[model samples]
Target: MTVSVATSSRDMIEGALARAVQFPRLRYMGSKYKLLPHLARAFADVDGATALDAFAGSGVVSYLLKAQGYQVTSNDFLNFPSAITRATVVNQTVKLTAAEVDTICGEPADDRDFIRRTFDGLYFTAADREFLDSAWSHIDLLKGHKQAIAISALVLAAARKQPRGVFTFTDLRYDDGRRDLHLPLRDHFRERVEDYNRVVFNSGQTCQTRSGDVFDLPAKSYDLVYLDPPYAPPRDDNDYIKRYHFLEGLSVYWRGQKLMENTKTKKLEKKYTPFSYKRTIVDALSRTFEQFKDSTIVLSYSSNAIPDAGTIKDLLGAVKSDIEVREIDHKYSFGTHSTAQRRDVSEYIFIAR
Candidate 1:
């Protein structure tokens, strides 16, 4: 039975991707949304009834796999990305109603600007801070995947408003005269919610999301296990948790949570992960490959990142036969300003089956 890919669901995905906002227009440090077409082509012949997106950042890769009729198990360490996974991958057709959006924005039971009080003068404007404080507080009004969708929309709104799409530093300083900061952030939140709602369609699969360390979860046989771990920086710790801590706070609704001070950001303590350490990259990659050795593995990495493509292929080759390395000229999320540096970097996709 040849099922046509030209159905209404396919058209919705095509239209959303073609739009200016892009599908799931999420702002993350190392998202592979733009590289999905290449990834799809790379895994074209590898038939799989199920796929496990081991490091499912932004849930775009998992959503793409679900769109292609694969039962996807999207996993992320962060609660924010897990919310995105729930909304997009797990919940196939549920979307927020206008009334629900109204409640989420208008009445959140926040008497004080919780965001302002906690992150005073750090990230957003005073008004924007109040909006977030109220919005996230009321996110619990809805239940199940709808709440996750709303909270994920809030994460998107916060990231879009933040300069550079990272929460490492306060972008909305009084002197930093950026135009994006001047807009009404609440409006952006509503717009993002509606956009996400519009893009929702049934992928017709019992897709799901798992939140926590990939190793902590029980290993299951998957046709293809996609891994796109946080890139190991050359020096210093650059974990995703540190970069997007604000989203983490929002996802969990930072209330009564003990926050330790981080010297780098001076906002909140950064969660430590071994995968982001230069000394542990080889060992971490080796363990990950061994854990998923029973399944076909596809790893996404950057040419400029630590361990390089040669080292990664060597690691995977030990556990799986038929290792293949492919590269596409790519630009970094932060290193796009200098033409020379941008031209030099390449995105590497390593396939081991």
Candidate 2:
């Protein structure tokens, strides 16, 4: 199943490594931004030229693989994250121009008051809601990678402006007086556009992005597959759509989505994912490992999760004989205090082949 690549020169590999660091930082939950160095080192020994990031939450791991010159495929069920990978990973040279940015941030041509009517005083200010409705109208006019870039910027802007970068709550209870909260949504959009643009670089490899259930992907073989599924913690929940429903709706302009009118936050109904529930997680992991058994697999799990590190190793061992585990002490920035008073936990990496 290993895809052979032409031998890369030392200079070429170094150049790729250098470009990997240019990826922009995100305030996303469960992001692997701080562990990039650890991930890079773990992947240093991989001899493959093709890799699949099965659950590219923040797309940082996919960007890392692409920078290492692996023809990377980044997949996420969430449209906002998929848009991010589309803008950065799949999009090599396409960038949104100043005129395009201005157009997207300008007034709407028609009286589209969807956000204003649907979300008045719920998430953002009145002016911000008007701007969002206007920007989404202009964003729809863009095509291909340009549209993806705009969506990515818009989503990032909304996340940054929201207190704690999530939509699970409407109040500023957890407000830490951060600078991102004070910034206007439109200003954040403009700044994020520049950040995404600066991260765009030619990796000289054809990368791709997919938005769907992981099992729905075509049965394509890659030399390496990285798995970082949502950790179903022993306590609390990992419902991403609940925390990001606004961004998800905005990603597709709520075309086919129906808001749950009974919900306090006006959030959409939660999408079903086996990885998020303790009852289905073990089976889900087993199936995932068995599906990609032909490829070298690297899994990231947490100490506090439902299926412990030993259970994960056992699951991987069932597919591959050779196995190795690496442990790193990592502290999460966001989590429910009800789970544990301390945020510190051990991050586990399991390599199976």
Candidate 3:
């Protein structure tokens, strides 16, 4: 079925698009970047002044909601994505200055060699690893959102430098001769800083961010809550931490994170989340739905994921009587299969009130 956009909401969406131009879009897996138009249409008629992006993976949805005039709260279990949301969504006026960027990219004050030692030959080159070491030292010196902005840029730069923008495998085997893969990590960091800075604007609403389990979120009322949980695909390839451990480590500079030294990639010990596993996903979904039952719910899922569309609808039906499902044809940019094997799938948006 077609979802119509309210005229006022359409105007807000146009404003959102204009603001989004400067946002340094990530080639992040499962990002809603491509489906934003569909999401905007789904959100257009939803009655909400306050919204929660519960699984704010790339923070784009929270930014969209912000542009549409919602006081948004973006949350993610991963620190790296949380840093991105902090830089763009929660942060209102803070922008990294030219001096700050130079300081971040400049030589380190002390010899800190964590990335250099632990990840010597894993994801980035020796020079890039050394640059990351220096950048991490300076990034920690900045306070609050400025630090977050720097971390966000660093994470983006690292991802851009990597082939397919994932840390699942080492070496340049998947290199596609993209310009981003050739640029120095430092250059990528500087460019990303500018791009992120340009996207920073006052949404005229006090937005915030949360970094923790979805269940840990305080029982609070919002006009709406948007959920885009990690889809439990038939295969076990939706392990975001397994794919993004390096970026996650970069976000926190590996502090308090246990590195699985025996692994070839030197990834961090996997963080626990009920949503990523088949055994716990149904209970997780039920809990999430019931926890925010007072708010209008907008859930994003994939046809390739577990608990299929009909099952999800029934789950939501138990909580709210009125429900609508909208589907958009989509193809993911990155997958574990060949291009020919990567089939088109329906991205489903379940709206309930």
Task: Identify the leading candidate in terms of TM-score.
Answer: 3
Candidate 3 error regions (>4 Å): 1-9, 337-340
Best-to-worst order by TM-score is 3, 2, 1
Among the numbered candidates, top lDDT falls to 3
Is 1 or 2 the stronger prediction by lDDT? 2
Q: Please give, for residues 232-272, the per-residue lDDT of candidate 2 as tens digits.
A: 97777888888889988988888788898788788988889
Query: Candidate 3: global Cα-lDDT?
Result: 0.85
Give the winner by TM-score: 2 or 3. Answer: 3
Any idea what lDDT model 1 has? Answer: 0.75
Error of 1 at 67 (Å): 1.2
lDDT of 1 by residue, 221-241 (tens): 988888999888554445676
Q: Show where candidate 2 strays beyond 4 Å.
A: 1-18, 333-342
> Compared to the true structure, candidate 2 yields what TM-score?
0.94
Give lDDT: candidate 3, residue 347: 91
Model 2 scores what on Cα lDDT?
0.85
lDDT of 3 by residue, 1-353 (tens): 22222444556777776776456888777888888878877777787678899999888999888877788899989888889989998899999999989888888968999889988778788999999999988887889999988999999999889887888899889888989999999999999999888888887788899888999997889888999998877764677878889999989998888989999998889888887788889889999999999989999989988889998998998899999999889885336535425568999999999
Estimated TM-score for each candidate: 0.88, 0.94, 0.95
TM-score of 1: 0.88
